[model samples]
Target chain A: MSDIEIKDNPDIKSELQTPPEPGYSEWRKDENTLYNDGLPEEEKDWFCDARPQKARKSVQVIENFLNWARSQSLWILAFGTGCGAIELRPLVTSRYDISRLGMQPRPTPRQANLIMIGGYVSIKTLKRIVRSYEQMQGPKFVVAVCSCAINGGMYWDSYNTVKRIDEYIPVDVYVTGCMPRPEAVLAGFNKLKELIKAGKAEGQNLYIERFDWYKENQKKVIKDWNMPDYNW
Target chain B: METLYKELKQYFDVDEFSVQKASLAFLRVPKSQLVSLLTHMKDIRGYTHLVMVTCVDYLEQDSFLLTYLLHNYSTHCDLGIQVSISRQNPVMDGIHHLWEQGRVYQRELFEMFGIDFPGSPDVHEPMILEGWQGPPPMRRDFDTKAYSEATYSHRPRDHKEPEEYMKQQLYPED
Candidate 1:
């Protein structure tokens, strides 16, 4: 009975070969690798025609909407990644009253329009920052607080702290100091507000549409298994 | 105009002492007299606050730039005294003996940048990380990305499987 059971077992396979599927290669091409002939003759007329006028009109509307939207709100993601966070507290606290200028810090990236990457962002924290930036809705901005975030003020040589956050994420404002003064941090905040008011704060989606660099960098900064809770 | 600067200049024969337009003064003193210089700054200069003591790692130039950002509530001016030291085996005396706040900044500079501050009460224990074993993590050579991957625990990131969605659309599950 044991010998018969062993011979009858279906788990073992004598040979293995990859299955073949027709039109597999035909469908596998990325946007850039298309073959004109491979497309159906009937549908060929419907494909690849440049709509310059329609494209222009849509661009104009989006440009107008974005310009108007940028002025109304400029949310800051309070990263508070290091000791520089100390100064930021007073800005938001009762003394400085940062909210007077219609500015308040948001904890979650999803709700933030700007990311204040306070102090030196270590590579470990950078991964989280990148993920946060991604989860945030469109029209985002970043501020590198302190000289450390710009070029690693004192921790430049340390293995853990990144010299510049710009290498990992695009920064719209840079406040310089070992840990920048409260006034300097306020200056950066004001600069962000001015940029937003000027209708200059463009969203990352513009770059994401033009080039694949953002997408490639997004993957490189964060490992495939490390990320969770991303928003649509 | 601060008495501490005047006193130190007389006693130490500092190389240069020039006050910038911003009301901040830059005092350049001999490296040997730094300890004495710090002592007088705290005692007589009215520079009571030790804002931060940090080092800039300039590997290409082979120097560690030490900056002491000091503020005097009495005088109401912020002064940043910057000094460059040799990168290899850097050492300096702890000024914790002078300003009480220097203790934390000095120890922080030591742990974060590995600049040895002798007489510091606690310089070896990790402040930002646990069980760190390697060159000072802030040095230009230290790869932060690699260290982060090896050290810290990360949360999961969401990613959609677009191809899988397309396949599911064409072929329904049983």
Candidate 2:
């Protein structure tokens, strides 16, 4: 193309930047139609529709529903207080396959639905437990697994452990036994599942009502790590 | 009590001892000799785990009870060693050196019950509280509810209308 002709024809200059339009010549194919040709029928139908459909299914809503369903499947936070926690292994492991019931064990408090207070908790452990409870997200559950959590069992008189865990955080299920058998823990899980199905199992959110309780406990537990420097 | 009976005969100077329950085994030792007994449990009895070390204030008895919950994981035995000390000066030897994890419990006990462990490192610094100068709240003498009430002032429940207050309105009782 001559410089004078290119200067006169703006379309020619634009065509140099992009490939010439397919419809411009008999040799040219339909580019828009060609690009869209590979799309499936359903997607094409969706794109062609003018008015919005009522309550279109979203990836977010689907994911939210899946998460809600999965949350019902409690993930036990591995915060074992004493020997009673040993039985949890059998329930989680091959013997009972607690996973069949959707009760999986998790290491972190953030991911877990249930924080099982196993056996006797020392004031030290109680501090850690309360901190863990605070860290957990909304819709958390507390399962007190032994007589110790209920009444401190054998360590009731000992200055180390609180007789009842209820003094600090709300407990959902109290599984009674000195060292509760694996079957008993499974029963507790079943009970928790029933509660979940019944809509009775909602995440523990007592801190919203009593904010100072957390502050006092945090001061008592996380002494060195204060709120100013630490991430909650 | 078979193990306690045999262990008492083997270790303790006093063979005669009382059994509290089938599960809970307790042995009372002289306050001065508590360290030696703990050391023996650690070295000889293989009760390697120091589950907890706590001080209970027995104000009526005019004494503080120091209890050590020792566990031998191999034998699955829990031992409770108790030593009664005068409440006036609650001092005992620090057992941090015996069990590695005992330092945590010892430090907490020091702060919570105000029990002075002679050789306990880092006992002065607060375990759970920062800038704490008052008597330990866990101590029987320190009433938490009373302390809280004294420390905090309650806000008025009822609100005054700004329009009424702007005029010559007195604070109403009704």
Candidate 3:
């Protein structure tokens, strides 16, 4: 094609490079979304009226020491969905053997208490992750171990990948690196243990409390969700 | 190679045929004559191995060029058959009966290109990318970069030369 031909041709510029369709904005106008759009009239006032009951303080029990013990021995199910998976192999081996710290990789989500989201969690994988997160029993902690889990690292601009794992499930510790070393992963586990000891890592309870919000976010992206609202 | 090309040309009015360096040859066949030609190549020409089934997008022509690559194990020769179909409505004859493994590649092509193989069983099932809502992403018209921008939110970054930043960190004098 000649210079003038190139200048005049609209095909040179892709439809995507151009702005959205002209009537899209006009059609979307006058449409306001309310919080209780689908809810019954009786349940419309529920959100504003709902208030969490204050926790009653109690004396520490002898069984409460299990929290400290549990912190020391964290069973992790590495959801290695991206490049950060390579770093975790060494964590089990001698060089940066995190298994020595009692941080072991478990196969089943049911048997595991801690979940380490290794790098990018795409929209499809996010559903399974949420189900796995919900399957674990109470007193569970999450350590999001990679930059992708934090804010989508390499796939930050990809449509399918989720930006932040924390938005979907409660993340106790965030190990920041494009692909964090096994040493950094150990540090993150150690940090999570510290939070557990201090009684601050209550991600499980938080997840339960904000279940609706998380489910809304999850269902919005994952079309054709045939599973139950909550796995539990 | 000349005998093979001439035989194909004599039987069917092939659009284009060229013998590449070595025992490799390329043939552009119309979609209508694809199955019969492939069957003839496999049965008579001794090109038994159905190597792979793949497609290329011809954006300028507004069509998809589906290629079936075959190999002859005995002679160690390769033959590629190229067939172009409409981009808007891409439906092609399934060569799965010739080679059972062709079904797998056909399924993938269908998943990525939105092409349909009428006789293939795996065409309707899910492939690598499951529950895909967007257009056939491999198409030239499907702008993935734009899709990424629209679907995903990117952080505004203040980028600096990593070398200069490392120089300051390692050698403060520099």
Candidate 4:
């Protein structure tokens, strides 16, 4: 009976328990293989397949000066992932004008140094967020706004919404509120500025360091990962 | 509404006709005659606007009740046509020809309720819940809470009753 059962099972448990196939980190060093297996053969050439590298730090005096300058003139990418975007709108308005702190909304990620991930991130929206976050230049900082981005807030039990924003991307500062007022966002920005000036906010480098972990977490939820491993 | 219902009854095998208000009424029709009745109402009775196409899962009854709400712009009257389809084999006639927007609704129904509308364009394609692998979420049999728990990892909750928390905050000394 034991022999019959062993023959019938066919090692199903071992098959199910096998580790997932090697991700980007394992084969990223290889020059010949494609970075984007999801994309069609024709379109693969359009995207850059190069792996991200850590940005080098300059001399102490220059680095401090650069950090100070970067902190003062925070060019924020105006990408709203959820409802917290409504609060962000008021920051640009006359009442809560964010320009007073040298922070302004930049239309594109290429020019922006700061990104505010506003509110709950659904699976579909997380894909876009990851893409945008990757597109941003080095020395970039992330300011996760609202309770939703911090820990899923009201969408805690939601099937599609991602709970912690940090699992996907490194967050420099967190502003906790259920749709935080513009005042709280400004405060969060102030905290981010402090971190930047103190030379503590290095989320961009942290992302590159733990790229594999982030990618695995992202791929777990985003089933249809049709884009490149790295968006660049 | 009574007059319209009586008139519709004469042409189609419509049953369970009830007027909820002066301007709104609901009636159930056989699945086969749904398209014809909708076309008749649109062309003849002036209920031209297709407001929405929604479904209610009757898990106990082993059926799905589909509602096709139509609005008449001129008279400001809303008419809902209901069709009960079997749960085991949920399929419905596509009314995209009568109303172009019906295709979008049909697509939504297909994704949510797993109801197939054979002729509707892009009905099989996912409208929302992209790349979803589990059973149709909107079906009554699909346990959403269980699915959520199984699929998503939750934070360890330190929950306190709102009333108790509030009272504790306000009267800590007590």
Q: Compared with the true structure, what per-residue lDDT tens digits does model 3 show for residues A1-232?
A: 1331111224312321343232212212222312333335675555332222223323556335867788878888888888888888988888888777887889999989898788888877888898798778767888887788876787766667877677678889999997787778888888888888878888887765554555555666766564544555
Whole-model lDDT for model 4 versus the true structure? Answer: 0.84
Which one wins on lDDT? 4
Clash list (residue pairs), candidate 4: none
Q: Give a tens-digit lDDT track for model 3, residues B4-121.
A: 8887788986867778867798889988999999999999989999988899999999999988989999889999999999988899999889889988988999888889999898
- Native contact recovery (fnat) for each candidate is 0.09, 0.04, 0.25, 0.23
Q: What CAPRI-style quality would you assign to candidate 1? A: incorrect
Comparison by lDDT, 2 against 4, better one: 4
lDDT of 1 by residue, A11-118 (tens): 111111122222323322444333334345675555542211111223666766764555445667788898888888888788787777667788778889888877
Can you rank all candidates by DockQ, best first? 4, 3, 1, 2
DockQ of each: 0.04, 0.03, 0.19, 0.29
Candidate 2 per-residue lDDT, tens place, B27-67, comes to: 77877777788888888778888888877889899898888
lDDT tens readout by residue for model 2, A151-201: 657763453445557646667788998788888887887787667555565
Best DockQ among the predictions, by candidate number: 4
TM-score of each: 0.43, 0.46, 0.76, 0.88
